[model samples]
Target: MLKSMRENVKSLKWVLWLVVAAFVVSIFFIWGASGKLTGDDAGNTLAVIGRKKISGDDYLQALRNRIEAIKSQYQEIDRAFIEQLNLPQQVLEQLVEQTLLVEQARAMRLRASDEELRDRITSIPGLQQNGKFVGYEMYKRVLQYNHINLSEFEHSLRQDIVLDKMIRLLTAGLAVTPDEVWSDYQKASDSAGIDLLILETSKVSLDEAPSAAEVQAFFEARKGAYLIPEKREGLAVFLKAEDLKKEIELSEKDIENYYQANLSRFTNPESVRVGRIWLPFEGKDKALVEAEGRRVLERLGAGGDFAALARELSKDAKASGGGDYGFYDWQSLPQPERDEIHRLTSGQTSDLIAEADGLAVIRVTEKTAATTTPLAGASAQIRSILLDEKARQLADTRIAKIEKEAKSARSLETALRKAGLKGESTGLLKNGEAWSDNDPSGAVGTALFGLKEKEVSAPVYTYTGVGLVELRKVEAPRPAAFEEVKADVETALVNERKMETSRARLAALGRRLEEKNWEDIAARNGFEFKTVEAHKRDQYIAIVGESKTADDLAFTLPLNEASAPFDFETGTAVLRVRDRKTVTREEFENVKETQTAQILNQKKNMFLQAYLAKLKQEKGIQIKYDKFLQLTQDVLSRYESAKQ
Candidate 1:
């Protein structure tokens, strides 16, 4: 369609008016648009859309209700997402948007009943797992973790349902035909296939500098192109996660399969009791200490307190507390360390054991032999274990054949085909870290990083049970070859030069603008005062009469102050600072009318919230958020813990 439209436009060059008409009709009229406004606290609903009202009472209630809802839904603590709510602007906009959307849903006769509501709520993806609604406990906790009230969330959810239904109704049959699909495919796949010879300044001599007249004309034509963009100068500490958090959305089947596959992790590893004591390698007469420890064990065998003996004589940091080594099962400890500890049982203390730093005395305090851990007993761990198995399964499926075939194959080029595979080759891939070149599961990442050149692992598993993958080839890090990126280097140099020249122009122009030299600068630089009439805040449009740089600089100019030099993407334009005015009532009406619709939506939101609350109150809804949170932790923790 775009290609056809472009072609049509080209063909109708004589009828350019049609293009303008098409834009105006399709974009502004039919689709409709809203402006995000900076507004005053008018203590009013801009407008009510449907039945939901934003009465003064409703507005105040809405604010209080939103706050309480937030308190109910999430941990009252700081997190990145949570911090976003703290922003003054964000909070205000968010509340307003919510009110509008919810009330709008109500106005259209869009609604769900108690049973209908319950059914819809259960189906929400936010609270589903393994193709089933998460337990009531998990559901509540998930809401809390997200820092939202259950009522508010359902209110939000109901609004979404209503909106979704509206969208479906609106967009029904609003689709691209096969012609459209083919059109897209053609434009996307069509090759411009440009191969042109170029001559540059490097090819030209210094004597070939533009003639004075030509230079002036060129400068005049492109003067507005160079300008600085508006900039935010506040200090910002950008949040960058050291490790990408896993974002695994699992299917019910995958979860179930995963649960079935990793049953062992779900069970607590038959709780084993162990105590540890350490002797420093530098301890004087270590052999004597060992002998003494043995004698102490002998005393314990003769009914002495082992913990007391450990505290009195053992040379371990933990000995400070009478060797009351904390309780833990073997699985909780590091594997190599746990393996040694696992051999000991209740009443049996190890002899002077040498591990790393020093000799250690140890005793087993308690033990629980292998027991069948019930589903209820380890649901959290089971969920995670299941998910990991699923990721690994998926990863293995992806790479298993490649891994096996690569061993016997001569080259990756041949093996990839024989295994029916494509290695997602890219230099941008971080070593040992995930790149979204493949499934985004990090399974491919691990396989790629784990391999040593040709070394291959069988269908390797991933943190998510996406499936398995096999390592194929590893590319060693190397600087880019000049031949490979000569064009890129040239482009970079050109861009750099352009930026420098543009900034100089802006700086010079800014001086002229400051001195009321608009006419002189316009004539001298071949520019003019660009006017952008009736543009609302945050509206994206070309500034009429002014260059982009000048417009940007103008926006930055303090009230009654001249703008300094600025640079835009195209070029520099030092804008003469002009008057800034508050948007008129007409502008506010445009916004107010829209906000009124939102107020209507807020009414619906409130109604739904009240509706759900009543249902909970009447039906006696019960939930344990902690249990649910624990379940989420169990399912999600695999991505992090399994790798370790």
Candidate 2:
């Protein structure tokens, strides 16, 4: 259909014009279209790429689309994971790069054809049903479900295609040399054998413990390192929601209201318990795989037990357990597999279904229909949820009232009594220190550090409950008296002496390597002389720990030449190369293609990085770091609010 449409230039021109008209009409509804953002609207701008402003709303929508894509692959995602990704920063950079590419493409008079855009949209599998395009309705529904506007998605798609074309045009001529390929193959396949002497810190022992006077002198000389941590002492008045629950009373009307509002949460999707017999391709003849699949199906059809056949013939990891794949909803499986499963009833088996690498035979052992819990059934859960909400609200209100009264109160005790709560004093605590197990969330600790002596803190939510805090005293970090930390100082001094002694002994042993055999010296010192045979680069040596230095020394040093003591986290190592091997012609030939591909990929990545750097410099990219950070914080705050 798209080919025919592309062939007719007149129709294509009309379609392009219609798309342009629709884009122009939709600009009013879009959050920050060019020339439309001003005043309060202009504040929403996240970044500016030349004349184009990427708005906060646009960035957030893009982020949501990305999150939805990830959620499809992973069931449970959390705020910490999202924050770790630095998604807001990444999204902003992507938008800037995209805008740069689009500008360059337009400068080169490049445009995506109407037919090309149409083909791209229809080609997306999500917009198809029963192996055919489900038309515009299904496309609209997909966009709606993902919180994307149709116009915005189409615009983004066109931009992506244009940018991809630009990238291909720029990177078309990259190639790898034969010499580079051979070097990569040699690096990957070459192995080395070595004899190693291992000396560990734990092996070093002191003859005697340091005296109390010596320990005191050592601490006195390094008093700065022994200064006490700064601490704060304060009083906390807690307002627990569980305590507030005693005062909260829910009515039948409230329970019914909650049930009606959150009915979706009470509904369960249809699911299936399935067993599969898989015959993986494994470079075997495709005919053999298909025949095996058919044979399994025939056995099942002839009343042969599915589990017994699966255990005997299937290649899947679950084959050992009768190929039981456990429970799955429609969305849990790939569309092709899901469609095949949907065609089977409980106790019925599927025909051979071809996959990317294998053929699978599925038996729907059991099926469960979708269900919605009745009002009575859901009432108990709804009541619990409502009660928790009310309790939190009541706690917040009480804490707020307590905070107001505490500002003028002479003591936290008076304030607590007024608020109908108990107050406890937290003995001197370092910043970030918890008081017993009371403030496991560290809310009190965080509050206390920011408060001046005798100052009351505003209400802050904590893991245990809501609370108002008052800082009673501030303790500055100071050097401890000699007697106060004598035991710690003794321990430190002893360890330092042991390390010095070990270094002296290792240095003597390293010098003697030229005079005596390494094995004889190791035996004299009761150390193990271990040999690692035929290990490649990037492989770890067991006795020397996972030291790359030891591996490199083995490869670099000549035969029988011992290295100087190489100090690592664990201890020191003396490595001597025993033997070295080079890649043979036959070995190189076997891995030639794979090694060439790896080298080419590495070169391509480097080239792409350099090209992008040049483009960014040419475009005179500028970013306001403060504004970016502020926007990121705002986004995270909104996400946290939504989760709550």
lDDT of 1 by residue, 1-644 (tens): 33533332222321222222332122212111111121133333332323222223333233333433343344232223333564322333343444454444555787756676678756655444457765565556544533446665454444555666754553454333444444333322222111111112222223233444554444455544433322111100111111112434555666555556766544434555566665565746767766765686578778888777777767755677776555532223333345566787777776665543355666778866775446555466555554444444344344445545656773444566775645534233444455443335444455455454444444432222222233443444445444444444445445546656555555554434545435555556544344344333333434222344443444454643545544444444443334554434444444454445444454555665665445334433222212222233343343233211
- Which candidate has the top score in TM-score? 2
Put down candidate 2 lDDT per residue, 1-644, tens digits, no spaces.
44432233222222322333344223212322331222236667766666666666666655654554454445445556677887766666766665666678888777777888898877664444456775675456545543456776677566656766777777678888888888777667788888777777678878887877788789989887877878898988777667788898888988888778767666755667888888899999999888888778778988999999989998977899998876632234334566788888898888887765688888899887878878898887677566666777677677767777777775677878876778888888878777666567676888799888888876656544677779988878888877777778887787777667766676787467774467788889966678878878777677566677876786788887888777766666777887898778887888788888888778877987787678787767655433454445434532331221
lDDT of the candidates, in the order given? 0.44, 0.69
Q: Tell me model 1's lDDT, rounded to 2 decimals.
A: 0.44
lDDT of 2: 0.69
TM-scores of all predicted structures: 0.24, 0.53
For candidate 2, what is the TM-score? 0.53
Taking all chains together, the TM-score of candidate 1 against the true structure is 0.24
Task: Specify the highest-lDDT model's number.
Answer: 2
Worst 10 residues of 1 by lDDT: 233-242
List RMSD in Å for every model shown. Answer: 35.6, 11.4
